[model samples]
Target: MNFSLQQPLENESVKLVPLKNNDFDALYQVASDKDIWMQHPNKDRWKKEVFQLFFEGAIQSKGAFKIIDKSSNEIVGCTRFYDYQESDKSILIGYTFYATKHWGTGLNPSVKKLMMDYIFQFVNRILLHVGAGNLRSQIAVGRLGATKIAEESVAYYGEASKLNFIYEIKKEDYLSVS
Candidate 1:
């Protein structure tokens, strides 16, 4: 399993770099705020310890990356492909959290374009489980052309349980749109 894959993907506005230890400080600075994870199952409430745990989890996950702003060279958010099920030939892409300032600024579509383009190159399907009440994320996934497939609840942040809407986009469907 060659998970140490390095694929520097970019769009005009943002860049995706394989997250490394050196990125910890900057990533923490952006992700450390409780408000950022309000809708997230992994609520940190802006606590340092919680952010550390979040960072450690991402480090262990092979496909995680830091989302950067090209012009400003700032760490704006994080995104990743985890929960890989090789036998099913599928991977999940979520746990995406961006700063409030970056919201609704067209940065998401650019990031999605880069990620979906990259993932479609290797996987047959990409799945996204968004918080059911997180309408913002649901709309974002819909805009990316993924279809709703199922729904279920899962524990988040060790205590808070949340309902998630499962969305999937097959390679063929993505290619047709791209």
Candidate 2:
């Protein structure tokens, strides 16, 4: 099967739709809360101008998605699958953020499980890069059964390098768990 990030994915709790140019405003509404980015590498993303650049990159990536709540049919957050390395049958999933209201609600795992179930059909491994200081994200990925493999400085689109911990989950391990 072909691996295409533009494909829409969904589950009972969330729907991952291919992000469109028009989604900037609705998605931003969920992202604008300062508490949402407090632990993120770029806390200033709550600003319109800063988030505009992020929205631009997401549209350009062609692999980003606007996460929607299935029950409310409202936008809740955003995430993306990037840096696909076919040689190793691996891809990285990162740049994820959700509204503070959605935090600790199991939304991250719901969204990630949906993503993993779809992507495992085409890859052997999936990686996630979480900001080094972002303990919340680190713990979240750990709960997803991903193992920390490395730590390095990652340069996000339109942003400077930030220390990040690399977590990896192999298809076999994730499959067994599910």
Candidate 3:
């Protein structure tokens, strides 16, 4: 079976729509906040020049999504599914960021559950790369039952490599948790 990464996904709280070339401004508006990328590997992503490269990569990836708040109908963040390895039956989900307002509102897990529910139908495991210093993301992934299995220097699209912790969630593990 072919795996499609950009399929639209949503729950009662948020929606994931295929990101378009025209979405640069809207997504950038949410990402412009300095705090948003403070702990991210590419801390300069808040800059237009850097973010343009990131957005270009997302567009080329063909698996990026713009996250929208259902109630406000506003673009709150962006995420993507990338590096799908058929041999390993695994995929990586990262490049996720949300507005500060949604930080502790259970939206992350909901969005993750939505993605996992859909992708688990095609793959056996989902891997995530969290910035080494990003304690918030580390905690969040842990809460979703993902385990830190390794550390490596990961290269961001059109950016320098940075130390990152790899987290894994097997289909069975996610099923048991959710």
lDDT of 3 by residue, 1-178 (tens): 4868999998989999999999999999988899998888788899999999999999999999999999999999998999999999999999999998899999899889999999999999999999999999999999989999999999888788999999999999888867
TM-score, each model?
A: 0.88, 0.98, 0.98
User: Native-vs-model 2 lDDT?
Assistant: 0.92
Point out where model 3 deviates above 4 Å: none
lDDT score for residue 98 of model 1: 91
lDDT score, residue 132, model 3?
A: 99
The residue ranges of model 1 lying beyond 4 angstroms of the native Cα positions read: 1-6, 155-161
Global lDDT of model 1: 0.81
Alpha-carbon RMSD to native, per candidate: 2.2, 1.0, 0.8
The per-candidate count of clashes, in order, stands at 0, 0, 0
Tens-place lDDT per residue, model 2, 73-162, is 999999998888989999999889998989999999999999999999999999999999899999999999999999999988899999
Could you tell me which residue pairs clash in candidate 1? none
lDDT (Cα, tens digit) per residue for candidate 1, span 9-119: 888899989889888889888887777777765555358777776677677776789999998999999988887777877888877889889999998889988888876
